[model samples]
Target chain A: MLIRKPNPIRSSEITSKDNYLNRREFIRAGAASGAIAGASLSAPAALAAVIPDEPLAKLADIRKPSPFSTDETLTSYDDVTTYNNFYEFGTGKDDPHRNARDFEPQPWSIKVDGHAENTGTFHLEDFVKPHTLEERIYRMRCVEAWSMVIPWVGIPLADVLKALKPTSKAKFVAFETLYDPKRMPGQRRRVLDWPYREGLTIAEAMHPLTILAVGLYGEVLPNQNGAPLRLVVPWKYGFKGIKSIVRIRFMSRMPQTSWNLSAPHEYGFYANVNPEVDHPRWSQARERRIGSGLFAAKQPTLMFNGYAEEVASLYDGLDLRRNY
Target chain B: MNINTRIRYVLKPLVFVLALLPAAFVVTDLFEITGRLGANPVEEILDRFGNWGLRFMMLALAVTPLRRVTGLAWIARFRRMIGLFAFFYIAMHFAVWLVLDQGLYLPGIGEDIAKRPFITIGMLALVLLTAMALTSTAGMRRRLGKRWNQLHTSAYAVGILGVWHYWWQVKADILEPLIYAVILSALLGHRLWHRRARSQGVTPRLRANQGAG
Candidate 1:
């Protein structure tokens, strides 16, 4: 597999490294966008309006954009949080937003094991703190032909994988989501083989663009938005970015993903966002951006979700149409 | 006039208004006044219209069985109206999908109807419904005479295709579509049971009237 060097200087040139590191300055910097400003100012008020007496104090801190972030306009906090397809929660778009309200994201632990030197169950906080957090504004395209541009706050998956020190036998990385059927009501029904799973080639997992996101729109990850931890593979379809992650296993072979297992002919293992290759059910040539309202025309989908320049080399001569 | 005549006069207009309400809600949602369409309004609109189309089809199918069960002959009068309304909603659903969703892209819409199994079934339902709708008028019914009933019987096939289309489109959470399937089966079952009973010479009051007439 071909490996490409991540550009470290990209973030440094975008903003003053010192100011970007300071949480306060970062919040101020992010306030320029109308969506982020409205989100930061109104989140507490909105939450308060819903639950009049409860004090959600932690919501007051706004997230600042990292130097590595994209310049795309951010989708509104309402659209991002409300319109979700987290099948582990439910199949309806708003089911996750409604059902995940009582889900407890705290007291979380992630197991990092299989073909790795640093193999152990670690507390979510300890595992996250050692790496620098960055806000990457990415275009998330779903296999359902809908898309969203979200400002996600998290550490790169490469940083985490490098810390784990994978052995030579680790040819692929597989992820598993939490499986408590009681907490996750959708799991009660076998919508997907429970404990939703996803996988990537070793090279794809180590790509600089792959992130283990913990938050969106600057607040702590909402329960519905895969609270505590989630993967954000910008180049692939949104299902590849599994949510509420609990385990990461490095294996010698490509692991079966939830959708691919359910319908192999429709959903492929690679799942790279290629517009030319249509899903058996629907066309992927264009996608309707969430929150763009009813009258707006659809935007054409980009190859590898517009990250082709960075990650295309990984699939050098492979036929994307067949692999899809 | 008697109370029955008074009710009959008001019922048609009331049902007409009631049938138009779903379309009105869709229009308000399209304008974003109610904001019920949520993030993906096109999908929401398409889904709502399709849902109403299926619901109207079910209501149309229920008319014959309901009239026989209740022994209310007046209920049979509204059957054509309800069936026409079903055609209206399905047409709206197809229009939104073709014009708004597909952006008037004829080739793509044709390809979808021709290729995708669910879309193919849905289009078949629409075509069957259109034929029923066209032959529904009093003039056309008079001209075709006995053949009209045979053509309209295709509505049963339309209902089956509709429910199947709904069942096939969903990725998971088959609960809603499954409910529709059960209701449709019960409706179809009632017709079959009655037909069997009539064939066995066990004529109920309603069947006796048809036999005598």
Candidate 2:
């Protein structure tokens, strides 16, 4: 329910007394120079150019260099995903970033159950290490009206599932984020359900576009945004890319996800992030990117976050609007 | 002098300190952001202020009940300051959310409220708090008079909304908000029971005299 789109941009170079309008000597400068207007809008880019050399050098070796890269991505551990769009984490964009700091992710473990060949638990680190970190600049659309371009670091979910070897009967791969009432102070109320469950079809989980990320923007994941580990499905609503995962199960039947089960009509298991399938409440056509130029408007959303060419095959026969 | 005046004298400084706390927190938050505060300073600063608002509002609402139960009528003297504290921090909270987070965009902020029921309720609680804060003064109380009691009684409604507002806002692991909600419910229940007892002619003095040693 938290809406986090890109920040709005306005091109205003003149730091005159009246920031709102054009008048006087400062106005003379604005009148004298149209290029300064454009230059001022590029400030976010100039700021983006500066980066700490640490996280990039320490990039987890498990992730592969992203096959698709974009210069426009908001790449940083804290910026890309730490500020979540999860309503369950409080309706504020920064709530997850603020509230999740207390979580300790090092000693974590994820249980793999159901139709998976391995019914045992996997250490969080070990599980994370098998996959390589890639910088995937993907468009993340929230169920609430907003969007962001994130440079996520992690390997394909298929790479992890390939090692697990889903049993022949496995039809769906269900994921569960850590639901500790202790760390996630939000669990005091029964808003959706504990453990914040989500699921993808086995085929969808194995799709190359579905990633299990450890961190993003060359830094450790922030606690509020499901630090330690989370999923990144470019084609699905951001909720499907759950945070702070603790359990993963491959099931023969479609799994019961928290939101879909809570409100079948409002949220479906597919939860694909499709602009065509508008939520009953609001339009999903446009998105705000974080740190947009001073004068730029929010950009339009792409189908499958521009990963449609890669992920369209998975949803071929399904009606996204009906299933969404 | 009566006990009421004595209680008033004690509460004056206490109320003054509590009243100043919300502003102090805002100043503290600004100071912390200057990079002077300790680790996890931002969250600490935000919570310190936000929780102060919620607690102050609850205490302000408790004034009427406290006055009735203890017969210390002067306890009403502190209600305005406490209610205003609630408004002060809550407004600051909203400001922080809008400026720091959303960058003051109307459409994006509106979408968040509409999509998230939790946010909608939280904002609604703020609206109610603002109403209570504006009407908390003696001038409004006297102007409304009998209507004041009826209108001010909306505090109970706001109290419930506040608890739900906090509860709805959490993402996962909701134990803390639930605890807050339960505590508020029990406190409100006590007042309701006390009111019923009063209407039923049940006075503590009657019990005391009947059971005298």
- Among these predictions, the greatest TM-score belongs to 1
lDDT (Cα atoms) of all candidates against the true structure? 0.82, 0.65
Give me the overall lDDT of model 2: 0.65
Error of 1 at A172 (Å): 1.2
Give Cα distance to truth, residue B167, candidate 1, Å. 1.7
Backbone clash total for model 1 is 1
**Model 1 lDDT per residue over B92-189, tens place:** 99998987787877777777887789999999999999998998888998898778877888989999999999998787578999999999999999
After superposing candidate 1, which stretches have Cα over 4 Å from the reference?
A1-68, B1-4, B30-35, B208-213
Range of the 10 consecutive residues with the lowest summed lDDT in candidate 2 chain A: A46-55
RMSD of each: 10.7, 17.8
User: What digit string (tens of lDDT, one per residue) describes model 1 on residues A1-324?
Assistant: 212224323553555553444454335334334443465575544322111122122433233565556788789988999998998788999899999999988778777778998766566765665566677899999999899999887888999999889999999999989989899998998877767889999999999889998777656788888987899999999999999998898999988788887788999999999999988877788888888766677788999999999899999999888999
Candidate whose lDDT is highest: 1
Model 1 TM-score (B-chain only) = 0.94
Q: Compute each candidate's TM-score over C-alphas.
A: 0.86, 0.63
